[model samples]
Target: MADPLALTPKSSYAELPLRIVSAILIAPPAVAAIWLGTPYIEMVVLAAVFMMAVEWARLVGHDRNPWLIGAMTAGAPQPVIGYFFGGFDIAAILTAILFLAMLVMAKIAKLPRGLWLAAGIPVIVLPAISLLFIRNDPMGVQTALWLVAVIAATDIGAYFSGRTIGGPKLAPRISPKKTWAGLIGGMLSAALVGTATILLIGEGDIPLIAVVSAIMAVVAQMGDLSESAVKRHFGVKDSGAIIPGHGGLFDRLDGFITSLPTIALATALSGASVLQWH
Candidate 1:
C-alpha cells in the first residue's frame, strides 16, 4: 500500500465556498419543479441530460464535433419526454436519428467503432430512463428530492469524514482521495438523513424509505466510483469544469444516474405508484 501521506493533495473542501454557494443557488428551481409538479421537471432534466451528453462528447475528444454533439444533447432528453407524453414512439425516433448520426460521425472520424456505441448509448439512455422512472410516480418531485439528498449527503459526509479521519483509500486506482473511513461515514450519514427525511414527511413506510436510501447510498457510491473509473481511464479530472467547483453535469449527477434506476426497479417490483405518498 502506498503511503496516503505521500499523495499530492488537491483542493480542500473549505477553499470552495463559491462553488458551494453556486450549487445551492442552482438547486432550488429544479427542486421547485418536482415539488410543484409543473411538468417542467422534464424540461429541466432534459437540459441536464443535454449538458451531460455534450460533456461526454468532449471527454471522448469529440469537442470539435459540435453538430454531432448537439444532436446527441438534443436526442438524450427525448426518451424521458417520451416516457410521459409520447411513450416509446417519439423516443424511438430520436434514438434512431441519434444513432444514424453517430454512425456517420464514427465513419468520418475513423474512431474505434465501439467508442461511439459505448459513449453514446449511456448518454442517451440513462437520464431519459431516469426521467421516465420519475414520471411513473405521483410524488416524482419528492422522490427526486430524496434522490438528491441521498447523493448529496453521501458526498458531503464522505468529504468531511475523509478529511477528519483520513485513512486508507477506498479505491486508490480510481479515486485516490476516497477513503474507506469516508465511505462508511458517508453511508451512515445517508442512512440518518434518509430516516430523518422519512420521519419529517410522516410517511407510513419508514422502513422502506430507510432501506431504500441505504441501498441507494451504496449504489450511488458505486456510480460515483464508476465515473471516477472512466475519468481514470482517460487520465482527466472533473469530466469538464462546467459547474465551477462541481466539475460537469456528469460529475454532479453520476450518483443519481445509477441510483435512479435502482429506485425505479424497486418501485416496479413493489407495484408502488410513486407520487401517491402522504
Candidate 2:
C-alpha cells in the first residue's frame, strides 16, 4: 500500500467544490422523488434510465456509429417502466428480449465491443427496476433515503479521504485515484450513517447496521470502480458532459446503478425493508 500521508495529484482539488455543489443541487430533487413515491419516483427512474442508457451506449458503441448505437439501447427502459403498471412478467419479457436483441444487433453490426454494448442494457435497466422495487415497499421512502445516504456518504468520504490520505491505490488499474485509506474512510463514514439512521429510528442493532452499511460502502465502491474500468476500456474520460461538474448521469449515479439492484435483491430475499437492518 502506498503511504497514507503521501501527497497525490492536484486536479481533484480544483474540481472538489464544484462536485460538492453539483451534488447538493441534485440531491434534494432525488430525495423528493424518492419520498413522493409512485409516479414521481417513477418519473425520476425514467429520467435516469434515459440518461444512463444513452451515456452507456454512447460510451461503448458511438465511437463510430453515434446515434444508431444509442437507439439500440432505447428498448431497455421500456421494460422497467412497464413494471410500474404491467407487472413483472411484462418486465421480464422485455428485459430478456432487449438483452438478447442488443447482442444480436451488435453481432450483426460486427462491433468489436458487442459484449460491452449489450451490457449497457443490464447496466441501465436493473437499477431502474430496483429503484421501483424499493419505492413500492410500504417503508419505501425511508428505505430509499437510507440507501441514498449510505451511498452518498461512501462517495463523499472516499473522495475526501483518498485525496487527503493519499495512500496506496485501490484497484489502481481500474481507478488510480482510489486509495485504501479512501475505502476505509468510506466504510467508516457509511457505518456512521448507518448508526445515525438506527438512532434516528429510535431502535435497531447499531453494530449490525454499521456493518451492513460498511458492506454497502464496499458495494458502492465496486460500482464506482466498475464504471471507471468501463471508461478506461473505452479510452474515454467521463461518460458524457451532461452535468457541468459530474460528467454524466452514469458518472454520478454509478454507485446507485450497482447498489440499488443488490439491495433490492436483498430486500426480496430477506422479506424486510433495508431500513430495518435489525
In order, candidate lDDTs are: 0.66, 0.78
1-278 per-residue lDDT for model 1 (tens digits): 01111112342555346547646766776677667664677667677777777877766666676666776677666666666667656666656666666677677877653354435655557555665566557666567777778777777777667767777788888778778877776777778777877777666466666666677777888878877777777665776676564577677677776787777666667666332332
**How well does candidate 1 match the true structure in TM-score terms?**
0.83
Model 2: per-residue Cα lDDT over 85-135, one tens digit each? 787677878888888887887788786777887778778888888888888
All candidates: TM-score: 0.83, 0.92
Cand. 1 Cα-lDDT: 0.66
For TM-score, the strongest prediction is: 2
How displaced is residue 49 in candidate 1, in Å?
Answer: 1.5
Deviation (Å) of 135 in candidate 2: 1.2
Q: Among these predicted structures, which one has the highest lDDT? A: 2
The lDDT of model 2 is 0.78
